[model samples]
Target: MTAADAASLVPAAAAGRPGTEFRHGLVVGKFYPPHAGHHALIAAAAARCAVVTVVVAPARRESIPLELRLDWLREAHGVTPWVRFVGVYDDHPVDYDDPAVWDLHCAVFRAALGGARVDAVFSSEAYGDELARRFDAVAVCVDPERRTVPVSGTAVRADPAGHWTHLHAAVRAWFVRRVVVVGAESTGTTTMAAALAARLGTVWVPEYGRELTARKLARLRLDRPDATVFDVTWDRDDFVEVVREQQAAEDRAARSSGPLLVCDTDARATAVWEERYLGSASAEVRAAARRPALYLLTDHVGVPFDDDGLRDGRHLRAWMTVRFRAELAGSGVPVVELTGPHERRLAEAVAACEDLLAVGWGLADPLLPVEG
Candidate 1:
């Protein structure tokens, strides 16, 4: 086959058996990276199965590392809400370069699902056929039309240049639900976020960053721009006052239900804006900026300026990206940058936020380290 043909080959979800009544089904995959094809296969498998249990390869010794591959499977399946990530481990290290252990990989799968009344097995791999035989259940291969769909992770990593975008989306939602929309003069970050929260049935956090920035501006006597005062002691009094009301709202939202939280600007963004406009940074102000899931950096789009002093044109997007990354790096929180026209950028942000949320929430509480 030509290189293009080779590269075009993508893992397709195997067609699952049709259902009239509920059957106990288990879907297993290395899920190197969950993609749309896997999604199709999963939906089919779950429909026939009353309770769908997703079995993922826990050992990432092959490629893509261990943790990330597991996360991909979790997020990909988490998007469904009904699906879940259960462990299937190969705890004993095997020489990946040796072919002897490839067939012995089912011990973890066996242990994880031991004693369960599994009616059938679902997978897109030929090895899945062997797994079905071993488990004494019908092997439901995902290749539809009785066509041989040849695709595997080896093919993907074969070329270091291969794109994994298709694979990443397949199971991204399980980890965190990301909403990275912008707050402009009018498109309503608040209103759009509220609407999205209502639609997705999640909680909404307004751009608390805006209120924080406004509060910081009020505290700084910009006329003395040359002053050397640069710690939270001098700059944080205004921030404390601003956050008093803001914290109450966050406290309420934190206590409320919903897997996703719609945050208005975070305290981190507020700190960056203060430092930029005032030419200084303090320890206390820096602490608050690290709190938001991400920053939207509202541009002069959507709604026109109605005399709000917060409007900063020209360098808004570029500067926000820099300032946000700089502030967030200390906390090791990754930020996704969303940019475009008024409504488009806002929507992009929301989508990104939902993706992160999918990844974040997918982890079992015990596995997830609590964030301060």
Candidate 2:
């Protein structure tokens, strides 16, 4: 392909035109740390589509670096020819939220592969319907069960092992042999999350603030009322310092080839909590949350109110859960939940991942032709 062709980043086409190709799918995600669920979904998409276009966002400072994420995709997953990885340009003088983002950004694609003819868009998201209507194609939801699996980058970042056991394999592999676990108090969030991590052959990031803070400042009694210049800032600073340490630790864990890096707390969720407890977050805390493959959330099912360590009542948990859902919902990332029966939830997460992968990538030609 020529430079122009490569720049266009077109999807592979069949022998057709305005009629649109019957195969070829597009799956877009951050794939921060591609996990098992992502792998399953991509595999499913690959089976259904001839070509899969994977659109990735370059990593920001707070998030896992882009270079590392790309390496994982290229080295870990191998460069999938059918799968074209394109990064959306935020610096471009275009509004990402605008409806024209696709028209403007996908132009290069259209320029190169207009003749390719796209017939369908695959996804498990409600927006899939809109994409189909907008693209004037069949928007397919590949989840055989049509059920939504609850997982989020935030949740997993909090406690990978606790709640991320069921994350897509593609995601787990990308990050490392680690599972992130996020949940409220008294959930034995640490204990259970660790157990799951051991089973998955993944490293684990214990709760940084709880452990690190406890080690350093937790003893100083930095109560909300004391509000001493020394105590308050010291504790927050300790927490921040712990975050940096954890960030380095998580990055180091991601660098190796073992089990997934089950993070104890993602920078994003941690930032959220910092604001909740500390009144407001420093610029530094807010910037640390951009990394993580996916967030896995623990549901209200088994979680109960607890005050063990820096935790509030179930009300706070519920609020945080809602916040997690809302923040991640629009982030174009995937979230999986570990609620319901263990086996059923796991199966559902896997299936959702398969559907997501299929939707995100045109990894392979459909085993069968599209029905007219």
lDDT of 2 at 78: 56
Go through the candidates in order and give each one's C-alpha lDDT: 0.51, 0.53
Top-TM-score structure, candidate number: 1
For candidate 1, give the lDDT.
0.51
lDDT of 2 at 281: 69
Give the number of colliding residue pairs in candidate 1. Answer: 42
All candidates' TM-scores?
Answer: 0.44, 0.42
Task: List residue ranges in candidate 1 displaced over 4 A.
Answer: 1-22, 60-84, 91-103, 144-372
User: Candidate 1 at 230: error in angstroms?
Assistant: 19
**79 Cα displacement, candidate 2 (Å):** 30
